[model samples]
Target: MEIGSFDAADASLKFGAAAEEAALNTNVVVVGSLERLRDAKDCHKLQRVLEASPDKMQLITSVARAMSAKKDGASARELYLLPEPVETDERSGSVRRVCLIALPSACSRHNSPARPHALTSCLKGNAGPGSLTVVAMLDDPSLAFATGCAIVRAFPTWVAQSSTAAKMQSKKINVIFDAPDNEAIPEAEIAVLSWAARAIRFTARLVDVPCNILNTTEFVNQARVVHALLQSTLQARGEEANAVSLEVITGEDLAAQGFGGLYGVGKAAAHPPALAILKYYPPGTSAADQATIMVGKGIVYDTGGLSLKGKTGMPGMKKDMGGAGGLLGTFRAAVGAGVPKKPLYCLLCLAENAIGPLATRPDDVHTFYSGLTVEINNTDAEGRLVLSDGLAFAA
Candidate 1:
């Protein structure tokens, strides 16, 4: 899947202003907060792409107006299908469908505005293999990044078979941000949003893959790929020395280095366990500079070890590495946007808690990086073991 952006002028030319013919065979969906949809200027800019079909435009406007009149607790989203397929030029041989969606105004105490979640749900099946153009109306420019991230989440990139892979391989999603009062979003902000979307999709894909295909070794390889990409990017900017650096300690080396917690949990798996560390030292840093450290539990899969979980409880243990995946994505996104002013460290304590003859049984004792000993009571409690080593290393 690919995500690109369009400024207001570019959107006008590409969608409707420059030519009488609408974009051929495209699916256009416009999304906005309740306040933005009610604003005259925001609504006008959002509907600009539909100018060729005034009847369809009128239908969408009527629905929006009707929604505006409803009580505060009304449904968070409303989708309206165009009454007729948009006319197209002969060479294209297809017509277009337009959809309009309104996001919720209310936000819960524990959540940000409901717009991002609502938008993601509304876009799920709508973003198939064909071309899709999303016109998003934002009250604040920063929401553009959230909107992009949400859209990427709607289209995940994991499929089991080769035949189904094609369905997930290629998709084109174009986003145009229409700010309140028709203000233009800065080019720099758009670039950041694009990188964020890329990172989000990358992380989601890693989490979606099963442990059989994405074991401890494959996870390390994936981290290396991100490291290599970061190096290339820094090299292009003539700041190669500022790039993030990676280090891996695996197999017996983990035990030799006194990482008994990590080594013990993963010793039984077919693949050996590992601890991967990534460090970023900005230029001109000194000993006086404060450092930030993040540690993630990268259990490739958890079978609860000898104290095993029931079949119903173990179905999705492959997602045990979500913390690591999320941290990796955040690190990549932060570096891509710009180097941090402070020093940064990311520690991925990777292991697979598979049951085997070598597995840590109940009452087993293991020493951690902090020189502390812990007795294994419930083997399913392995996440804390790996995390303890990572935190001790960070300290």
Candidate 2:
């Protein structure tokens, strides 16, 4: 209906009388599948139009036509639309620049002339442009990466601060739907990957910053900004939440929890150790799906202790909370991405490793919140101690 000459041989004849009528009046939609690709012999038809068009390539026109004629969803739009070739062999003079788009669900079910293999076969393939987005039945519904994450890479450019992670992002592709609705899940999975890309990038930057710039208070303030987005009830409390909650505990409160590791580590710093907790419960879900308790070890800076590490070990110590960074990442994912209705609890324990007059001495004995006793062993191997308490609490 948008243009004219949409009728391809198969579609032109198969469309119910009504679709047939519409095809007669449309040009952009060539109501057929592979058959329509044959309209232009050699280079004068569709391929020529592709090589010489202004809008470049738009699938909408093609999709509408395919939809009108195919009896089933087989007519679902699948093809390539690339700004440049994805694969090429110069010696064979084979050059292909088009991006690929395929239906993973349907394609994975494809049968050869006589046999059908596993879906893994398709996924393991080169994954040409059209092949990346896919229909996935995620076995786990908790973590984003557990389900799948979208990774993207922008382009080639040299910058003093560029990271390998950033470079990986540039060439990144997305995972298809993994949603509540069976049909929409794959697409939803893809959408969440896109969302995480936007949200996680900022988190990476925040975690990468030096401790001097990003402190416990700063972390709390930023959390306030994020909480304001949905304007859900906020908490910096020490108790369970009514629904959505956030809590920060420190000093005597931590001591009462029997968190000796946290206390001992902080005795050396000007500020006491603080445990930040965030929780979100969805009314829609009766039983939380594999509720995950994510804990981040936010040691702002590490000077090692009685057995201090060299500068080389402490260089990127700013990211010592990388574990916590990942937790915050999961927390934000639960909030930003369309996480399935579930309760998520996050704990970010922050402290600074400083040499103080009251600093913990070598061989100091301490007990974790779980009542696990540990020898001062080594001062810097602190991430594991804090996480033990966090894990015990979460468990």
Candidate 3:
């Protein structure tokens, strides 16, 4: 999956004014707030940007108006098939699909203007072997980053497919941010959005992959890649002094270092557990500066240890490491954008809570890095144990 952007000049050259050339085999999705789509002026400007035919424009506007009349304040979306099929290259065939997504007027206090959940829902399963262009109508330029993040979340990278199908799944995704009145988004913002999309997809892919493929060892290896990239980036900018450093304490070493919480939970797993730490020091002034530390619970898979989860509860346990994945992605993005001014530390408490003879029992007692002794009550409550070890190490 690729998430990219096109400037006004580039878009005009590729898509043309009326999408005559690009619309043939491409899937196009137009997304915006319901209130904006209801306004005649705003909707007309968007139509001109997409170069939609008069009939298609009418269909889109009518749908938006009807949705607005519901007065229920629920988000709505609709897909329209093009009347004519557009031809593609000799290899792939033609396809004609268009989706219009409208966000609700009502928003919770924390979520305004854009609702990521609604947007992701609208984009799910829209992928194919062809190209997809998303025209996001935004009231503010900064929303473009959020839009990119949401778009990537809808298309996760992990999938179980045959080699032939996997080869055919590679698709092109382009995002065009059209502000109010069809205003052009800046080039710098577009670049940032692209990077953000990449990071988001990276995180989502980690969460989507199964435990067999992405175990504790694999997670540590992935973090090492990010660490190396950050180091290289800092070196390229002539700020080698700010190079990132990584430390890994695994298996028996964790137990030896008093990380009993982490070692206890993962001792029974095939792959030994680990505590991976990444440290980033700014270019200058570090010893006296206060550092910001982040801890992530990277439970590769949770089978509930001795207190096993039921069939219904164990299926989606692959996503237990979401916290670690998110932090790793964010750290990579932050460093890629620019070195931060403050010292930063990221700790990944990685483990797999598998039930076996070596697994922690309900009566087991363990001492954490903080020297606090905890009596095991429920082995299923493993996330807090790893998190406690990470926090103690950070302190």
Which candidate tops TM-score?
A: 1
Stretches of candidate 1 off by over 4 Å are 1-25, 38-56, 68-93, 286-288
Give each model's whole-structure lDDT. Answer: 0.72, 0.48, 0.72
The runs of at least 3 residues in candidate 2 whose Cα sits more than 4 Å from the true structure, single-residue gaps closed, are: 1-187, 230-242, 284-290
Output the number of the lDDT-best candidate.
3
Instruction: Provide the TM-score for each candidate, comma-separated.
Output: 0.85, 0.53, 0.82
Over 1-395, each residue of candidate 3 has an lDDT whose tens digit, in order, gives 21112122122222212332243334667777776565533454445445556766777667767765222233545555355334753333333455666765565778745677667875775444455666677767667777767866766545656453243235455665667765666665565555566677778778877888889998998988788777887787788834688999999999999999999999999999999998887777474689888899999999999988999999999999999999888887776666468888889999999988899999899999999999999999999999999998888
- Give the range of the ten consecutive residues with the poorest summed lDDT in model 2: 1-10
Q: Which TM-score value belongs to model 2?
A: 0.53
> Could you tell me the lDDT of residue 41 within candidate 3?
36
Candidate 1 lDDT, 199-242, residue by residue in tens: 77778878888898889998898888778877877677677644
lDDT of 1: 0.72
Which is better, 2 or 3, measured by lDDT? 3
lDDT of 2 by residue, 118-174 (tens): 222322332343212222222223333332322221111122254643343343232
Q: What is the TM-score ranking, best to worst?
A: 1, 3, 2
Cα error, residue 233 of model 3, in Å, equals 2.8
